[model samples]
Target: MGEVRLYMFQTGTLKCKYHDIYLNQGEGRDWEIPVPFYVVDHPRGLIVIDGGTPVECATDPHGHWGATADFFVPVLDEKDGCVAQMQAAGLDTSRVTHVVLSHLHLDHVGAVGRFPGARHVVQRTEMDYARSPDWFQVGAYIQSDINRAGVDWFFLEDSWGDFYDLLGDGTITLIRSPGHTVGHQSILVKTAHQNVLLAVDAADTLDHWEEKALPGALHSAVDAVRSVRKLRAVQENTGALVVAGHDPEQWAAMKRAPAYY
Candidate 1:
């Protein structure tokens, strides 16, 4: 097996209402959370996980994020662009061969169009739902950000099993843990030493993982709960480090780009 190197970074912070993140608690309080993304180096190629916030969000949040920007505003600049971050870290952004999205949310799928010819992977369920999401979810999946006409798309299905070895090297694996969206998923990376699980929106914040608190917006609360529980069991069994999707506290303490897990 090839050695794997994982890099974690944040594009910026999103200002969202507390109630919107942690179920029914902190209804009126606004909070800022990190928009974290990961890049991994494997013998196969460079793979980017959840393409940080789109570069456009840095320039004009409203233009790219639409009305949703009113509620969940991104505080960013051009420096936070996926390419810029990689370049700064001495990584060749142009060498990125694949981009795996945890889900189709605008924030996670922002890099879909950035890497030309790079294979973009997402759950088949997510691709289908993105075609015509419930009226309430349209803003979360911005058409401008996801309308990548020329990029290669590799849609995955959960029918295959619980974990899909993305490269057949067992270095990067995808876990289908829907809840935040119809087909949301998380990533599990096995390095030489330990396992690291990026519990994307499935566990948006540590609060969700620790207390089983429901995230505010959901297609199905039942599914959300089940996904979190599944993630918990996976963590317990694998002894993997569970990184919350947008945890403010966790993001601050963790190392950013130029650092690897």
Candidate 2:
């Protein structure tokens, strides 16, 4: 039973339509969901999972995102950003050891370039798809962020299993639960007292996880559904408290950074 420390950050709040997250639900209404990123303080390394929207989006969402800004507008305070949040909480950014992106989505990969010294990790399939996404997915990847120069990356092409034990310590496990994107993944973080699952976009909210709604975005709907079930099994097996990607209610209840979990 190896354990580590987990710290969560609310980089900003994303404003989008209800349909943007769930399938055929909450149309015509606007939704404000939290954009959260995480940092794990482990004996082996300081790991980061899923950086939020680009910090530049705080000042100029339009200029930073271009036309895609029309669909997803993020509202963030000047102090909002993964790097800024860590600094504010008294954590050293230079100590960031490994940055693992859940996928190369606009929101998820925004901070990759900020951690040049850290080893960035992602699935090979995700990297490939992000390079030349279909028309539907083109707007999701901001090439400048994911394809940033001088950033060291380590791709995992695990063919035999879903779980990759990062650091070989069993404290942080990367789970391949794709569907929201072709290579989207989730994370399983074990702290001293609990197993916390960062179900990044695999199950965007409680609605998706409960099958009350499906994700509006998908590379494969079939795989999306399967991945939700797979996450459920992980939750059951580890007794993990599952934290969905951008659920407003869940985010509200969570203890933000400076309060480790």
Candidate 3:
């Protein structure tokens, strides 16, 4: 195994409603947040966690996202797509071997087409939800893109907990953590210095984890709370650096152009 380093690809940022009660007391406020996609350096190749919004959707007036678009809008120019961000970091998108998605939310899976050659990994339950969604309950942002890409797919059928070695080298693991969605998960990158847990939408912001707050709207509020507690235990047990799904503070603290370890 080689030393693992993390790079934040700021495809864009958006002004979203602050969902943490401590921050807003049940009231919503506009806040700037990073639509961050992460890249991990592994011994075998680079891996990207959650592709941010695609550049084309930015101007699609009748896009599927609807009003939520205004909340998690992409502020980056078309030229600043994930591919461009990867190039800026001295890494090519084509070199990425795998792309792991936490869920199929439009904001999370928007750039699925960017890495056509890479295998796309998603939970089996999430795929089922995407294929036959209760349109009234869920949003379908990547359904068309997923159908068009014809990308290779790897589905996780069994429960994933403890640890998972993606490359069979004990370097990269996807720690199963459900609740925000049926198959929501967090990525654990074991680096030489310390382990990093990319807690996707399991916790949308740092406050969600720090305050143990749940997402305002969830399929299951109780389950969401349980997931948050589970993640907290994982963070405490491993002593890993935890990164939230869309924390504005994380984006502000990160170096935009070059990659950071």
Best by lDDT: 2
Give the per-residue lDDT digits (tens) of candidate 2, residues 1-261: 345789999888888998889888786698888899999988666788877888988888888778899988888976897888889998888888899999998888766978758999899899999999888778888887887889999898968478898888788889899899988889998899789999989999988888888988888899999999998999999999999998888889998889989
For all predicted structures, in order, the TM-scores are 0.96, 0.96, 0.87
- Any runs in candidate 3 off by more than 4 Å, and if so which? 19-28, 64-72, 159-162, 255-257
Could you tell which candidate, 2 or 3, scores higher by TM-score? 2
| lDDT of candidate 1 over 83-124, digit per residue (tens) | 889889999877889999999887787578787778998899
Question: For candidate 1, what is the total of clashing residue pairs?
Answer: 0
The worst-scoring run of ten residues by lDDT in candidate 3 lies at 17-26
Candidate numbers, best lDDT first, in rank order: 2, 1, 3
User: Model 2, residue 163: what's the lDDT?
Assistant: 87
Give lDDT: candidate 1, residue 132: 84
